[model samples]
Target: MGDIENIDNLLALEALLQVTFHNRSLLLRAITHHSCCSETALRDSYDTLEFLGDAIISAHVVEYIYRSFPNASEGDMTALKSEVVSRRVFALIGQQLGLFPFIRVDIANLRTFNERSRDSLCADVLEALVGAIHIDQGAEVARDFVARAILPMVEQVSVQADTNPKGRLQKIILQRTGSLPRYRVLEQSGRNNDRIFLVGVYDQETLLGLGKASSIKEAGRLAAREALETLQKQRGKASIIDVGDESQPQL
Candidate 1:
């Protein structure tokens, strides 16, 4: 929101993104959170640009998956896309870009920010940066940015998605219940950086599993894995019970 005063911030950000901006103001706005905006009426924050960038990034990711995975089924491509294009993944990638120090937020909020809030902020800012690039340099440059920053993650995500417990659980639940399994945060503790997430997966009213990890997404994955294992055991027990039923009449 500052006028021509955040030049140093702009230069550092440009170096980080490796894309110089002609409209430095746009870049500045991209790093500026809504809390820093002094006026509600003025266009001063990354919120709108983040929205646009969400669509732009999704489009680019979808196109890339469609072309690169031509032999894959629709379900496969979708599963791959879901892993790589998620907010948690984006936040992880954004951290590697070293964008945190350049972001402008209210001092109070910044001080109190937890890992979840930090991840959300990083993801939103990355999207806003793409939106700013699309506006200042056009769609191709924006695509290039994503190619450099985001697409490299697809291979890693693909490997994980191949055996992704979360995805597997979703498929099973969707097939059996005609609805996806739900996850709930059970507990949290520790400081901002060291925070832990305890999550539980549920099938309607039944609790299938619980897991604890440093991130919500990872915790959810663990919970799903547990649920799958539990289901397998239950099936095994059912099979044993059926075999032990000697009350059945012989044929």
Candidate 2:
């Protein structure tokens, strides 16, 4: 997109974000990537803004969590912040905001990268925007933006605490069975830009379950979850069978 058109689109996005910046130039800089401008150019890029926004986002998220969950300890708040500020989470938020379509990247320079790789640009733009908002509007506006746009979507905190399958499975197997659960890389395939993996969960050489995902960590978690479910089922059935075995047999 042309410079004027890009500015117009950014203004429209600002409206959608419900933020009016006192310094419109900062907003423009936030959306403009280094790829959009050459090194010798007079105009500033989004990198500095992204760095500032990273700090702002983390602080706001931590403050919100602190107040929202007064009973939660510092460690719990730190874990929550890590998950919320992860690259995956930011990319997902950028996608939700439809920032990719509005980003201006030279097609010639980006022909080698896949869609997932290009998404990093969108994430950077998001951080830059946050930085711009914090600078122009202040911390309250930035906090409100995060609360409205990002906080509500982070509903998996409790689920994360309870169903940390990998940790729970490891502890259970080690305590009861006196052996740690093993993970095997069952398969790995996909394009160089985006790889997929399938992993299996084994308990003492017994293949208990399997799972597949776009990342090895995710695949391992899925396998552990499946193994946990399988073990629970076996325990339930054994309980039932044990009760039956205690009953008197009919002649």
Candidate 3:
């Protein structure tokens, strides 16, 4: 980690993100990880910015979906929103922006950093960047950045909506049990910046399946998928009526 006064890095980042920062310090702060904050003498970390950014992204997404899909049901709108605001989606966009090279982290922390940590870091930095943009410019500019840089990913999600396990599971459970599926964060571990989430999906009072992943949303989706598969298997079994002739049904 170095000083935030590096003009070259600032210029490079501006070029990379296709957004100019009026305040370069916000840009630097956006890319900084919490692990490097104390060592770099930065009084502010990206956490606060990330929080703001998360809300900003969510609001924009909700508005976008609501306007774009006026006839869509609440469940459909929710499904689409989930795809857009997901941590996995954010991390993928971050990777496309080449954010990893620009992220500042302490060397000691680097040793323990795995794919999970990388995904979380990229996701956080992207959100923080959004926060930074909103602060330095305005909501319109931030919205433009999101629309230009990140919104295109929505196409992929739209195409792959059929493969969304959570949505599929929701439909199947609603049809079969006439009840909504429930998800709970069963456990969380690791540092705040790179926590592992364990989520469980329940059908009413019974625990149907469990899943673990880098983010709670992903973990919940996985759990729903597992539960869906389990329910499908249970449904696959032949009933007594199906196993024998209906004409000889008397016991």
- Give TM-scores for every candidate, taking all chains together and pairing residue i with residue i: 0.73, 0.80, 0.69
For model 2, the local distance difference test gives 0.79
The predictions' CA RMSDs to the true structure, in order, are 6.7, 3.5, 6.2
Candidate 3 weakest ten by summed lDDT: 238-247
| Model 3 agreement with the true structure over 3-121: per-residue lDDT tens digits | 55467788899998889999888898898887777755445578888988999988887887788778988888887888788887898888888898888777585657678778779
Better by TM-score, candidate 3 or 2: 2
Clashing pairs in 3: none
Clashes (N, CA, C under 3 Å) per candidate: 0, 0, 0
Candidate 2 vs 3: which has more lDDT: 3
**Cα lDDT for residue 21, model 3?**
92
Q: What C-alpha lDDT do the candidate models reach, one value each?
A: 0.86, 0.79, 0.82
What lDDT score is found at residue 25 in candidate 2? 75
Candidate 1 local lDDT, 73-136, one digit each (tens): 8978887887787888889988988878888888684556767677878999999999999999
Sort the candidates on lDDT, descending order.
1, 3, 2
Q: Which consecutive 10 residues in model 1 have the weakest lDDT in total?
A: 155-164
